[model samples]
Target: MPVRRDRLRRAGESAFGALLLTRMILMTLLALLMVTGGAWSSWDTARDALRPPQGAAGPLTLAACDRERCTGTFGPSGETVALYQRIGREPGETLEVALRPGTAEVVRTGAPGVLYACLPLAGSLLLAGIVIGGGLRMYRTAWATAGAGIALLATAFALW
Candidate 1:
């Protein structure tokens, strides 16, 4: 009787430990997914934005060019492309720009295109930091990530 009780207790202890381990693994995986998905989304958008215009560069009839950005209709696709963080050109004047592949965005030939492309990436990192910190309890790493994102955004604005 004593031996049987001992065996049962041991088995229960082992099972409890296993359960805890499983829970930890599951939570870790979820955290990783959140961070990775956020970063990937940002990277994909940035990649598309940074890529140089493909094929022949075309002209756009500027519908409006304010202090912040320029909006114009691309002649090739007849689509509106907003040029962010770029110098404003005349509202009615035609300017040459390269259309971003698979997006309704444009970049001037000599503009700082990479900085503009990275704006969304910084935002994503900031959100990911919050998720990792609040959901996963990784406070240190989360703060660091969030800080980096803020710095990037600040840099973009300053340089713009």
Candidate 2:
């Protein structure tokens, strides 16, 4: 009976070790995916920023009319230019500016591409690390470390 028990224990240890190795490999893959996604996102943002403004009929100009009122002119196309008034503008100051199309849509569209790609990768890594680390710790310490790790992984997934 003692010999049988020792053999069972060894078998269990071997199985656990295999599980741990698998988890580690999965975590490494997730990390790599996250890094690649982040790099792609950075590149997209840079490309968008460097793009020149298009379809400009002429240069836009802004002239101060008074302390509170300002007039903006859109070159030959006579396109209605949106004006944003700053509170700090002093009286008799003419701030000439060129009107460009808003890039908010572009940024908004690009953000999801980056986040969706990276978030899943990071989340998977975190989950695998938590599960393996917690499982091993729990076996050694007979504590609730595994539960804690799972909870942390769940929290990260929720936030992501």
The residue pairs found clashing in candidate 1 are: none
Tens digit of per-residue lDDT, candidate 1, span 1-160: 4545688898999999999777657766765665566567656545544554466357778888778888888887788888765444678877656776666776654333455556666776788687668766789988998998899878866654
Off by over 4 Å in 1: 1-27, 54-69, 73-97, 102-104, 107-112
Per residue, candidate 2 scores C-alpha lDDT tens digits across 44-153 of 43343344246432444454344544555555565445333323334333332333356212211123323322333444444544444454332432224334445544
Where's the lowest-lDDT run of ten residues in candidate 1? 108-117
* Whole-structure CA lDDT of model 1: 0.69
Candidate 2 lDDT trough over 10 residues, lowest sum = 103-112
Task: Tell me the deviation in Å of residue 158 in model 2.
Answer: 30
